[model samples]
Target chain A: MNRIAAFSIGAASGVVGTYLTLKEREDLKVEPKVFKYGRPDSPVSFHSYSAHSLAYDRARKIPLWVIERLSPHDIKKEITADRHRSNFQPDPFVSPHYSSANTDYFNSGWSRGHMAAAGNYKHDQKCMDDTFYLTNILPQDLDNNIDYWYRLENYCRQLVKKGYSLTVISGPLFLPEERDGKKIISHQVIGDNNVSVPTHLFKILLAEREDEEPPLLGSFIIPNKPVSDCPLRTFQVPLETIEKHSGSHFLQNLQRNKALDLCDKDGCKTISLNELTLYRYAQKLEQATSKEALEKLWAEMESKAIKLDKHITAIYKKKMNEF
Target chain B: MNRIAAFSIGAASGVVGTYLTLKEREDLKVEPKVFKYGRPDSPVSFHSYSAHSLAYDRARKIPLWVIERLSPHDIKKEITADRHRSNFQPDPFVSPHYSSANTDYFNSGWSRGHMAAAGNYKHDQKCMDDTFYLTNILPQDLDNNIDYWYRLENYCRQLVKKGYSLTVISGPLFLPEERDGKKIISHQVIGDNNVSVPTHLFKILLAEREDEEPPLLGSFIIPNKPVSDCPLRTFQVPLETIEKHSGSHFLQNLQRNKALDLCDKDGCKTISLNELTLYRYAQKLEQATSKEALEKLWAEMESKAIKLDKHITAIYKKKMNEF
Candidate 1:
């Protein structure tokens, strides 16, 4: 509280901040010059899969972020990998003490939503299957998981379909909002392990256009809850905001000023999901645990007000039962 | 909520847990045995100082932990360095985006408290000053900073005086407690940069006694707020608990059964602060900002009872003014 204030801090810091200027290894040497005491250990760890790489948060038992690159060739026409053949599983590489488990999401009134969407990795069966690992999932809201968020992922692929390849980064965010005059970041955690439920989710993309034009960089910070009313462009934010919130720098290889705004270049809009897709979504929603949530899901279903023919309902019911 | 329950999580996890069985760099290669994608980037960074090394959380702009090995020789007689001459400064190596500044704590109604204390590094002025880097600091409460927590640090040095060399790990914790039937971790952030103010602070100590016997490991997690009534031993919890909360492993090379309890070996008690010591603390208190806080601090002073008379008060006032 002894108010040292800003000017003093800025002045004092400019002198000592140079300690790390020598290298990215950032060895800091001060006067009287002494060697480092010991090696530093990473509080978080990174893992790789066929289509993606992710940094896991050891403390939260969740992935901090997932990075994936999608090329036109990687986005093939038919499903080369059937997601149905792949069941969700825990990652083998992470220690049990730190890794998230499939059960963390099972009946916790939340769905294990993929950060790197399984459908995006369909070029190879293994690529799609690996996306089911717990490290790539989060305790996501059912509505957000299978509906709007699903559409966003589709939107990413739509761009790929439009002849642009993309490097996508997705992650959870425990964002602070003004609550009762204080900026508070609060979220529920699931399972005995207390795996966190993020309040928001982010997707940052670098889409490389054909020809000599610079690639476009765009970012979205969407609420974890469903948002069906607004356009996808409403969620778009500056890249610096994402770095400030996620603590991870993205597109380090690209100069941001030279890059174009993704949403500006290619409009951010999601097509309405077909009826069969919504029925399939209802199947995933069946796994949600909370009694109130089940009731709420039914309420939402009733509000949809679109009923398919009896034959389709019968077929959907059979498919749902099989699932 | 689909309450999948604890049993389901435990059951599902045991089957797929072996992916990391091969190595610590747990490369989880699933069916199809495909090579990994690009390398995952670390969300956090690490840096080293002469007396300590720390893992810095890039997003939070704070050190996750600071570790120091304090031997008998390291605890020099009298003071080889005066802390009065060493002003707090920022570590140059940390990028401005991810590093905490002296400004973050300035006039933020919190103190810049050192994890590896300056007093503990009196072996040399450089070592002592290196500990002042903002990377090794937290936004600490004023009352706890100079009083109870100070005594606990003194206790660590006191153990070193007893022919024991100590390896100490210190950091801040954002612990959650049951609020309205839900576990919520909530803390106020300080400065325009929103530097996090931890709700609790921890000190994990591994003290090796002067013998062939194995070392003792003990940990304490104390509330960031002032606590004048309870004994320090009340804060002593099992090592496993600290691991769960902090997500950092300690005594990795030593088996638990061989190690003894640190608090049991040396009684967990703090020596009373003498009259002069209390007077100096009062001077430090003057920097505190809140009117209500100032009132409460004076109230705490009056409750201490015994007075130090006029000449001492005059000298203390002069010192306070100078500070």
Candidate 2:
């Protein structure tokens, strides 16, 4: 019985090896060019392909088990890390660690700039926060990260209109350090509490349109200063707070109504001063500085008349024209 | 007349502006993911396809001009620099320039290695040599290049049975600095004194066989030690002497036979014996005392009327048995 069992094991091993060899041979036969380096009987085969092709193929071939395990956070992390590995530096504004004193450029007075605006993401914090990975960080002048940055953000928003989802990662390759020292990392102070330094940042927008081929990647480097504008920005609010406050429900509503297109649907126009007062009271509750202040603000707003439909229309129209 | 010329120029400018705007819009339509980081507007696009797809799509989208503009030597340089960049921290066998000279082990020891080994590719020198660049350099041990590095010098006689034109490049990645305390670019020594170091090597085989790919790349990594009873006297000789003594006709014949699989067929096959000879003679010459000793060694084999054909047959049989 033992002898028979040994024989069976040997036979199974032989069959497995033979099957693997045959499969490899078939693959080589189908595309001889793939084995241009010559088959070495190694487990891993090396072949050269373009970055875009690799990404698409990988996305398709990812095992179901792997996909099942991935969350929105996981997907965001993987995309963020991959972008960083490919040389995307992080934006400092959204990164809490940058403001930490332990970093190389603590309090260096440089702002972390995001090529993708936080608001355009409907203020999703995880998406915004992913831009804080070091690989996504790059140095930018303060003015450039603030002023022209908004323009570029608007440009990306415009791209969404044309059925293209923009995935932008941009930053300076090098930065001047302390006037004369070898250029080191830089940092930004956030809300008078935390300091941050970002090395690289990226924003990836998955396509919304059905007919268009989704953009699988994108990157850019901010040119050296002396030019008028680099056009990048740093977010004022923490991405987490923004994401929680904005909520997925609000985003869904915006998309459904084509709020991005700045249009309103179902004109059931009505106004109630009491409703307006209630909305202001809720807003005050969300933004109150202290418990006492919050109570006072809410009481003041609640006392006033509230209007709903008229206010919504006015705000919606104003946002539509702004875009 | 001046006013009419000014008007015509203004009309042309307007047309140009219209064209530029249209181009910008087309660019904006591109997904942001496709853009490379440093070069936002670069025209070059990269894509990877499966070997099968690549085979089917071949109208040779890679332009002839582009291929022509890039020399194998230039590519080698780029590849070498990239290897260094990727492997900034050198490993056990591969030492950095700063670390190589500091080691005492390499001085008294000889490694039993393949002059044209596949593993040497990570170092870049093996692939750059002209002789080892040939396809025929096969599974050689350390003794072959160090002590018997000469016995295998005329192994080309064994190649005829394989029914392929073998191209080989063999040379060293480093030439010891002549003066103490002087720095040397260990990877740049392609040839020296009309000859080149032959420690590093590569091989390519061009044969029309059912299983053989038209172009193939392989290499070997010779050990840093000497051995006794060097089974084969595969020695190195001075490349210049190999060409001058072998005669130009012999060299020309080899080139013509191997020219069928040029990297860029349309480009000129400008053979340089300088690079080829260095690679060919590296192992043999390293072991030989002088050019006379090398020639006398070959003459001895000729006088013996060596059964080169029989030896080649035996080698092939041996290789087949391994498989």
Pick the TM-score winner. 1
Query: Which ten contiguous residues of candidate 2 chain B have the minimum total lDDT?
Result: B1-10
List model 2 lDDT by residue over B164-183, tens digit each: 33444332221122234322
Cα-based lDDT at residue A252, candidate 1: 58
Question: For model 1 chain A, where is the 10-residue window of minimal lDDT?
Answer: A1-10
Which CAPRI quality tier does the interface of model 2 achieve?
A: incorrect
Interface RMSD of each: 11.5, 31.2
Off by over 4 Å in 2: A1-102, A107-110, A125-130, A133-135, A141-143, A147-150, A161-226, A229-323, B1-323
Query: What lDDT tens digits, residue by residue, belong to model 1 across residues A216-318?
Result: 8888999999777578889999877877677776665566789998888888777666553555646645555555555565556568774545654554455
- DockQ, all candidates in order: 0.20, 0.02
Score every model by TM-score: 0.79, 0.24
Docking class of 1: incorrect
Model 2 alpha-carbon miss at residue A162, Å: 7.8
